[model samples]
Target chain A: MAADRNAGTEPVVDMQNVSIRYGTDPEVLSDIRLSLEKGSFHFLTGKSGAGKTSLLSMMYLALKPSSGTVTVFGTNIGFASRDAMALMRRRIGVVFQDFRLLEHLSAYDNVAVPLKVRGMKESEIEKRVRELLRWVELESSMNKICSTLSGGEKQRVAIARAVINRPEILLADEPTGNVDDDIAQKLMKLFVEMNRLGTTVVIATHSQELINQYNYPRIHLENKSLKVFPALRRLSNAE
Target chain B: MQNKIKLNHVSELPLKKDQANLFLEAVTAVMVFLFSIALAGYMLVDSMAKNWQNGISGTLTVQIMPLPGDTDSQEKSLRLNKVITFFENQPAVESVILISETQKERLMSPWLGQDVDISALPLPELLDVHLKQGADFDYEKAAQALKEIAPFASIDNHNVWLHRLLDLASSIQTLALSVLWMVLAVGVFSIFYAVCTSLGIHGQIIEILHIMGAKDDYIARQYARRGFLIGLISGAIGTAAALSAFWWLHHSAVYLSAGLLGSLDISSGGWLLLLSLPLWAALLSTATSYWAVRRTLRKIM
Candidate 1:
């Protein structure tokens, strides 16, 4: 496996001279270079329409760069086959800004999707999914359809699904956008707990307060370019 | 709760109750119905032709006209007896039966009204000569000998008319088979269109699945299963409808022809083949759906 071939020596994600655009439209992101080491956590900060989602999409193997290379888990996204990209995606989890839960499904089923897609045994899936849903304090609402759930509840389900597989990298876009401050802090703690367990995390958000509350480095998108800001506070062991 | 989980595992895509799927099922049923009828027609014609060829090939008809200006009934009887004796003496002739007046009347009733008195009309004497199964009789020599013995007698080989009938039957079978092929092509195209439409309708779920690391085969299997079920159900309905129509037609034909069309019966094996059409339809549907899904997914990110 290419992943095994470059294990421990390569960054989890490495992008060099990457540019992306849709059709004849002007490039949304231009000449970007970024690398994310394993077990690291960072915040992606940018104004609206600044291509933050576009960059995260490149990392998650959802979009190929218009030019240059995006190498994820040691496989270049440009050269990887569709099956290979799927396997690569297995090691990454994503939380879209809209939650993107399968609304027709129950919260339990939505959270169980990642494991089901992986073809895990039902018993194993049930155990893991129930445990995670309980941790997110959604055990009671697990059987309710996601369409009926409040925004915060749906966000939790989405988070439960993303982390169900214990993916090596977790990317969130405005994950806390629809939650109260207390729920947002709890969600942050969940991401931090995942990071403490050696999972790399990247969060995209417009909340300056959330960014201020956490002391992680930031990948800020500006004027179709990228600039990385180092941690502003001393690091804690959990972070 | 456990049952719900198991059910959820059965299908990750929420593809049920789409108007497109209902349209597909209706279209599939109609196509299968047409195909089944065409196939049955082909099989029936093929069997009928075989029966006719077998029955007609081993027999010859000899007709003796009444002697001109001779009112002697004994002379007609004597000439028919001489021809019957001559056929009996031939190595290949099995049995020759003189046609009874009643039998001749029955044969003529279709052309001439039943009310007509056949005795009033001077009908020719007809003899049915059955030959040995593998007989290679010299038809020309027999005809020449009959002319010498009774100048008014002539032999009917039956092959000329039989060949014409077979040609007509063969043409019908070919037309039926062509219709069957056209129906199949239309069925495949309809299924392709339906699957593509479903894919478009469920595009968001599919993208979410792909982002969740679902393999193409994973999603394709669900669609295949759905296709198989729809095909099986619609195929059953179609084949059943066709079988009912065939039963009605067979009965109506037998009634109208007064048992003449009873020879068009399908053999047991043919019936079994007809019964298996639904399974074939289901398999075709499953394969088409799987292929269509895989091909479409390849174009996605």
Candidate 2:
């Protein structure tokens, strides 16, 4: 992997003093200033009530900041219309914590949904979906409904669906939380490979061991502030 | 730019699964078609019956009773000629056509035996009279004038039976119209309920598709296309069933009306009316589905 550089250059996401609240309650995310440069890999770590999902949702254009500026792909996202937001969302892949696969559709159909929404032809869509399913090792389970899949299989399918369209920004929220250690490590390696292909990847999880083991740049949220662990980087480099 | 999106979405519609639901839809469509045919037939036949009765009412029959003195044929002839002339001069009369002996004999042949010689038997002179447009026939005045010409002459106006038949025909027609309206309302209600059930079952599927970047139009298209397919099927099935029923009724009615003048032969115009039932059913199903889908989507938003 390339050495860490200034996040301001070609930043894929830029947030300035962002605060989010749901209907005038206590602020969940407060005064959060963050930037992730193009093709960078970052891990978001926080407690269960630390609003990690809220922050990832904002990155994927699913929520709006209550007070602050949000810029994605150089566009002022805070004022973007719904249509514009929907169009922008197609370029961002999100792996929801719950593995939000449609239960009615098969694994293959679920993966092809994003591409189908973009009006891709059947031949191209089939080739792309088949390739992605094979990548996730769900090729044999293509005909099975999402409900029939195991936790690890479901998570892999969700990840495959999120990245099938080759999104510029990939957001995974507790993507491997429900999987075994072996599967989790395999999924982490898959994310690493994806990050190397010039696709910015952001994983939000509570697992410090996974973050420390990988030694990627980490952003920690505590007391309504974002902190980057520069010492963890040195530890990984020395080792 | 927005129109381009709308047009493109409309043109490249997705192909839905060919399942058993489609078969049920076709059957429903055909039933509707049959219902339409019956309604149209009733309306057309009822209208024709009214027109025929109206024409019959406007005509009057004059019967000259046979003279007791058979040898006084010249006097009877002179009296009938004078009575005809007097009626022609009357402002209420348009024109009078005196029935010749031969024509009267032909009219009586159906009721009486054909072998009977009309010349030997004493027969009354019958004259057909038509009233002028915008002129009311003064029955009292015309009767008084006819009595002066021949004391035995009697004027008969066919309004009593004509009025009664007209009332019967009008009542039948109104009843048919009421039945048709009932069928329409029932059809709409049934479709509405069915569509609501369909939407309820597919609610989660729709929401999932929406979150997966599908547009509202795309989701609505899936439902509308399904509805239209069902409508087509129902229309055909309903029509076929209605036709078969109508044919059976017509055959039975003809058999029952052996001595009656009118049978159950509906006119071409009436048949055209019956054919409209299928189309109506199809349209009702489609509209109901559209409304159901739209209403459900609104709740989600």
Candidate lDDT scores, in order, read 0.87, 0.72
Worst 10 residues of 1 chain A by lDDT: A1-10
Let me know the DockQ for model 1.
Answer: 0.54
Structure candidate 1, residue pairs in collision: none
DockQ each candidate and list the results.
0.54, 0.16
User: How many backbone collisions does model 2 have?
Assistant: 21
Off by over 4 Å in 2: A1-40, A49-86, A178-186, A216-231, A236-239, B1-38, B45-200, B248-280, B287-301
The CAPRI quality class of candidate 2 comes to: incorrect
Lowest lDDT block of 10, candidate 2 chain B? B1-10
Question: What tens digits encode model 2's per-residue C-alpha lDDT throughout A51-163?
Answer: 88888878987667999998988778877654566567778888988888876567888888888877798778878888888877888788787789998899989899888
| Predicted structure 1: lDDT | 0.87
Q: Model 1: how far is B173 from its true place, Å?
A: 0.9
